[model samples]
Target: MPRQKNAFAHKKNTNENNQNKNSYQKKPEVIQEQPEPFEDLIPRIERLEAKFDEFDSSILEVRKRMEQYAKEREEEKRQEELERVEAEKAEKAAEEAAEEARIAAEKAAEKEANKESQKENEGSKENQAPEKNSKDSNKNKNSNNSAKPFNNSNKNNKNKKRYK
Candidate 1:
């Protein structure tokens, strides 16, 4: 029985060896090197973080400049609106002044026409008074001359007979 058991075990061992040989051969594994530690990568991380911070600062500066430009644009718009309003008001005032001047000119022209008509009336009245005075003086002189009109000299009178 011991010789039979020894033969059976030897056969099992040979079969195991044969099965292992029939499998695909694996390539020898090279010794893999370990990755670098965090202590070695700290400087690179710090450099990348500093670059990120610089990018963030640059973006912030750009945002601030954009806001400043927008504010300046708004101020310019406000100034233009104010100037437009002032120009409109000035134009309205000028129109009103022109209207007032037109009214005043019309009044002045009326007054001048009235003064001219009054002067004409006064001149006609003055002329009539002088003519009336001259006619009255002529009438008085003619009446006085007619009242003493008996001075005559005649040579051939029958009532004055001469004996020479």
Candidate 2:
């Protein structure tokens, strides 16, 4: 009987130890924190919003600068193109002036040549006039001499007939 009583007490002590081990193995409860109040988060949100606005302004400024640079480049190109066109026009004008000068020079040369030829022809005509006058004088003298000799012969024939 005492042995039975000691066995029962041992069994009760073992059951208590098993319960303690099981309790140690159980998962602990998770502690969840409450969300921050909206009022408390307002300042932080404002700060973030301010940072975004600053970033956007800087971006806009950079964009404006880029647009200004592009416009300046376009203006420079336009000015250069206009200058090139003006240069071409000036060159063409110069060429035209030169061509006109050349033509005028050629015309003057032709006029001078014509004047020289006309002078030469007049000179030749003057030289031929004296030769023609001299030839005509010689012909007149020969005809007069021949006519006088014929007249004398006829006179002699008439005198002989009268004497006969």
Candidate 3:
């Protein structure tokens, strides 16, 4: 029985080895080692480097354009500030001019009012003088008329006959 067991174990080991050999042997790995010549690879490497250089140059160009755009934007803001300052100056000048005009108009109106007042004073004086003179003349004439009867009595008294 021991010999038979030994023979069965030997047969199992031989079968596993055979399966491993058969499975591993059918497809052999092929190693292809073709050494590329240095001259042929140089142009390919140079083309790849040129492509990388072109990409880098494009990135640099974009950066330059962005910087220029930023500068232009800053300049535009400065121009806007200048314009605002100019507008403020113009507005102030206009306001001052308008104020001066208003003052001139007011002064002219005041002068006219003073002239009118002076004229009114002169006219009132001229009108009042005649009224006062006429009143004085009327009083004198009434006094003269009342005294005429007294004057005639005095004159006729010399012609009367005296009764003792």
Per-residue lDDT for 51-112 in model 1, tens only?
A: 99999999999999999999999999999999999999999999999999999999999999
Report the lDDT tens digits of candidate 3 across residue range 76-152: 99999999999999999999999999999999999999999999989998887555558778889798886654466
Q: What is the alpha-carbon lDDT for the whole of candidate 2?
A: 0.90
Q: Distance from true position, residue 144, model 1, in Å?
A: 47
Per-residue C-alpha lDDT of model 2 across residues 1-164, encoded as one tens digit per residue: 45454546656778789989899788898988867769788999999999999999999999999999999999999999999999999999999999999999999999999999999989998887555557778899788887554458788999999999
Model 1 TM-score, 2 decimals: 0.53
lDDT of each: 0.86, 0.90, 0.86
- Judging by lDDT, tell me the better candidate of 2 and 3: 2
Best by lDDT: 2
Q: What residue pairs clash in candidate 1, if any at all? A: none
Alpha-carbon TM-score of each model against the true structure: 0.53, 0.49, 0.50
TM-score, cand. 3 vs. native:
0.50
lDDT (Cα, 0-100) at 41 in candidate 1: 84
Best by TM-score: 1
